[model samples]
Target: MQFTIAEIWEHTGLFARMIIFALGAMSIASLVVMAERMLVYRKSRSESRDFAARMGAILAKDDLDAAANTRPDKNVGHLGRVINSGLTAYRVSSSSKDVAVESVARALERQAQREVQSLKRGLGVLATVGSTAPFVGLLGTTMGIVNAFNLMAAAGSGGLGTISSGIAEALITTAFGLLVAIPAVMAYNFLQGWVDARSVDISESSNEFLDMVARHFGGSHS
Candidate 1:
């Protein structure tokens, strides 16, 4: 007996068909998340880099007021947001140098955490799809096998056609599951690495901003 996709699909019961459709949806969702995240990260990095270069020049002059009021269009990137938070605190604090520094540090930390969490949005969906797709496929496979056995029992046949059809029905769901799962796992790992690298960039840039703040306040980076 020869099996084709259409043949196998025609033989599959309602539950197995639903499983395949669900897996297809999962694959589509993963791809959409990957594309969206990639675009967001790319835009964020470009904007942050440009903002850093411009701000670095301003901060190098030890011009706290200039940096604090440097709101260029308010379309800032991740690093810019963190740095801007510190600058906002610096601009408003009428307290002593130590108190201002503490406040600025706190602001930077809070914004950095928010930025990181924002970058990590939709990652949980990828993680869930990667970890669960296989099991979901297995569930479909189980149903397929049960249906195949029921058909065989109804026909009261132990022939080659019956056995082959049963095997095809039982295995197609598993194959579809893996097809959906593998790419999701890969995309999750790649995007996750990007987030990690961006996190490091945020941390390092936050430190640099703090140093500039301290120096402008006539203190040290420490």
Candidate 2:
């Protein structure tokens, strides 16, 4: 009747055991995603800051050609990509100022979308695991309670001990499910917030780059 881990597991039914295993897998998968996402975000942030500093110097002098040709690593991530896209468009566009500005604007917009999508990669897995893990755990709990009732009936006893094992088995799964789900949901929320913040940053940076392009091209054309 006592809730001992080993004893409870030993008495756990086959269906409950399977549910535990499934929960275990979900836990592992969510942890992996969390780790990978954190690592990627950290790396991208570092590389992007460095890239911005370097690009800032080049862009300060209004050297579009130099900025376009500056090849930073792929790790430079979103900001670098957006700027590079704009520069490339500017570098190869028609001589018409309006055409060049339009081309650069389009390129920046396209690259920003692509970068945002890239940042969102693997977030769905976290969302899925967070939302479903508790329900999956509940399935185990339900099965465990059913088994408990069956055990009590087979023993022909009304004592608490007769049904205690089943109840324990049922509750454990729910506990595990919550344990798995809570962190997944929290992590998902935190990561999502970070994404939102970064998205705003990218948008602002893109608009600034666009404004600079428009100013340079507008004056020349006028």
Candidate 3:
């Protein structure tokens, strides 16, 4: 059951390859998540800024349509879409006494929530991968250790050299798994924060827009 470092390397050849492949996959996934989240945050931030400026102009001039169309799709995030929905509803309901502005506002709020959820899509997958990768690595390590022990028992030797290869392979896989997990977890948290912050900004701006509309329509309570 005696093993040398060279034997360990030889025995772990395929396992090393598997670990490398797993690490690569994890890296790619993390990168994709980071890029997608960055794009979403950037678009939302830009849209919110433009919307704020346009809204300011609309408030001063009392031009609802102009404000509604100000940024269009580029500046329109989930919040923008919701605000547009409420504005459209309010305009259409203007002639009907039964249809209230509050009703339109509520509808838009619901739509906004849906958009938020959509934006948050794929986050769960990233979190799961991040949280579980280390455990998976540990599992690999445990298996490797078991195999090393089995080899030692088969060899009927107490020589550490005999099992060193298997142990090394196990350690290598575990390290690889952690390497994958660390970045995934970090990216998930960072993106979550970014999304939350942008969402807050979007909500605040939308609220302001809603209040402006309410005042224009002579609705009580902003």
Worst 10 residues of 1 by lDDT: 213-222
Which tens-of-lDDT digit does each residue in 100-216 have in candidate 2? 888988998899899888888888888998999999999999988888888888888878777887899899999999999999999999999998898999999888888888787
Comparing 1 with 3 on TM-score, the higher-scoring candidate is 1
After the best TM-score superposition of candidate 2, give how far the Cα of residue 171 lies from its true spot, in angstroms.
Answer: 0.6
lDDT (Cα) of model 2: 0.87
Query: What C-alpha lDDT do the candidate models reach, one value each?
Result: 0.86, 0.87, 0.71
Which regions of candidate 2 are displaced past 4 Å?
71-74
lDDT of 3 by residue, 1-222 (tens): 335546655677565557557766866787787788778877876775665565566667877766555545555666567677766666666543335557676767787787778778878767977987787777778878888898899999978778777788888777878888888888888878866876786577667766776666664433
Worst 10 residues of 3 by lDDT: 92-101
Q: Over 4 Å off in model 1, which ranges?
A: 219-222
Ranking by TM-score: 2, 1, 3
What candidate 3 gets wrong by more than 4 Å, as runs, is: 1-9, 13-20, 65-75, 95-98, 219-222
